[model samples]
Target: MSRSLQTLRRLALPAALAAALLAGLQAARATEAPVSLAAVALGEADYQRVNDALVQHHVVPRYQVMAAAMAALDAAAGRYCAAPGAGTLAALRAADEAAVDAWMGVQHLHFGPVELFMRSYRLYFWPQGRGRIAQATGELLAAADPASLEEQHFRNASTAIQGLPALEVLLYGEGAEETPSAFRCALLTRIACNMKAMAADIVEEWQGGKIDFARTVAEPGPDNPYFESAEEATLAFFQSLYNGLELISDARLKPVAGASIEKAKPALAESRAPGRSLRNVVVNLEALQGLYEGEGGPGLGDLAVRSGADPKLEPLLRKAFRLTVETAKGIEPPLAEAVVDPKRRKAVDKLLTQLVAIKQILRSRFSPATGLPIGFNAMDGD
Candidate 1:
């Protein structure tokens, strides 16, 4: 409830052999009660636990942290716009990175409160091209009054210029640290403020500002527009996990790394201007991993094991997730540079390979265990 940044701070198995290549550490999971395969089905009560742990512990907490981080960015923008100086610019850039990191943490989620106003895409639009960013940036700066950036106006503005992508255009790159243009400053502050607003709205709605979207997700009913059954609600999180991973592999990893190292396209990398492209996918993997494990409670993998799947599937997923994160972190240079550099390019390739391996493992084990049908994404890359 407090505006203070400190107050709101509440914060996969792979193929098997290949996953062990990175972060060679093993994770231990607590033992869960056994349920026979005959009873593998999730009843209304079981679904409630799944929803409660995911919504209350996983989704809401992450959204609150994102709001706090965006709030910090807004404050930093205000401070710098008030007086442009090298020190202030440097502080602002740091805040920008922090905000991007927070967004990355929750970016994979695309349902519930985040869907209220299409806030997710507005907060962080990616796969965006440089020309579009350039044009959007130019148009905003060209405005005599910069009126389009007004809170009410940004809502109607093209999403291209609305959030992180546009913010990167104005806040980063050469000479970005040195500034005097009044229009550029105004644009930066507005984007930051709008992002802050979106983040707050998401957190509030999830916590019941407009509607307890989290509870709506948790308790599905015949009359409920969101979900008809608790199992359906449970599947939404599953879909997010799969879809989020696919987005990373397809959108984030595929475009930059390209099919072969020889055809790399660094320009397409997300958040690359701030050197957060690698960090972006890394955070995404970590968050998706959290979703796989149920955030803090009985993750799907744990539930699968209890539901009569191989008990080893849970740890296998854990190992796969660790390896993927370790592999991504292991990349020496950021994506843009690595995609172009010959020697380092293989590291990126290996990361892509590891990511696919994680997905394959999920398809084979996690899906069957949880009893959730394999969706289109789960069937992808097959």
Candidate 2:
């Protein structure tokens, strides 16, 4: 054999080894942590009933309220297609609430078990948020002569509850006041990502034949099994979930709203310089708030199904739970580092800290099956 041929063979062996390593890495990334859907399976008929209840009890009431609001807002929409000029928006909001009440009444009238449905399965899917730019854009799109604003809004709202991003909104709940439109889109995007996390649970259950809805939710005890250890896939799933929560909390995940009160501090001397009028600042802030809190989105039913029952589902839920806990803990520091204004930063810092606490509490009180940590208790199961 020639000397060159020997060298080529040596190089080829390492190349093959490198290729093998790369393949392993990719395989790890694709292997998902298992998630069980046994609890979601009530039976086919029962599952259908739950879906029906979701639409009737949770979804319908939400839609009724939103539709009423949209009607009033659209009525008030002038040539500019902006909000109404008179008491229209206020009255409309009231009407929407009343309509929601009426819808709720109807649910009770027929199902009678509506409250149980709401408490048992609805809260998980409800999106209780609002924003300006996205709201305006949504309104604009809805009022665009050709489309139904209320319908579009309903869809956006549905996506929100599902934890999926809404129609145009991007991230869900973060960004500059001026860029409400862009922020809206960003907010929706993040919400969609969160839904993707839930989707993992759904697909797992579907595959297991446990989520028929007709049967009652099953609980998988200690005897369940596990799948191949795809740490990389689990990490990616966790990352997506964390991104969704971070977007909700830090608001950094959304689009950078149009230039307004961004984080940058003017030069120290500039700080001494006159800034935008105080009145304008106040107005802008109010407008921004209006955008954030005005709209509604999708909602979850009030069912607390266990994800860890089946051998396949436990790892995914556990992984997801762990990710959620980590996200709650990590929210404050980054925000503290980012904000330039001391007062604003301090306020946000406090708010984020509270949110972290709330999330921790929710995890502890609500998450009985996942067996992940709640703050210090998180170490309990591990």
- Which has the greatest lDDT? 1
Q: Tell me each candidate's TM-score.
A: 0.86, 0.27
After superposing candidate 1, which stretches have Cα over 4 Å from the reference? 1-39, 173-175, 376-382
Q: Write the per-residue lDDT of candidate 1 for residues 102-209, one digit (tens) a residue.
A: 888887777877776777778777776656876777676777476676779878788888888788878774347776588777788888988888899988888875
Scored by CA lDDT, what does every candidate get? 0.74, 0.30
How large an RMSD does model 2 have? 19.5
Error of 1 at 88 (Å): 0.5
Cα shift from native, residue 286, model 1 (Å) = 0.9
User: Model 1: how far is 358 from its true place, Å?
Assistant: 1.7
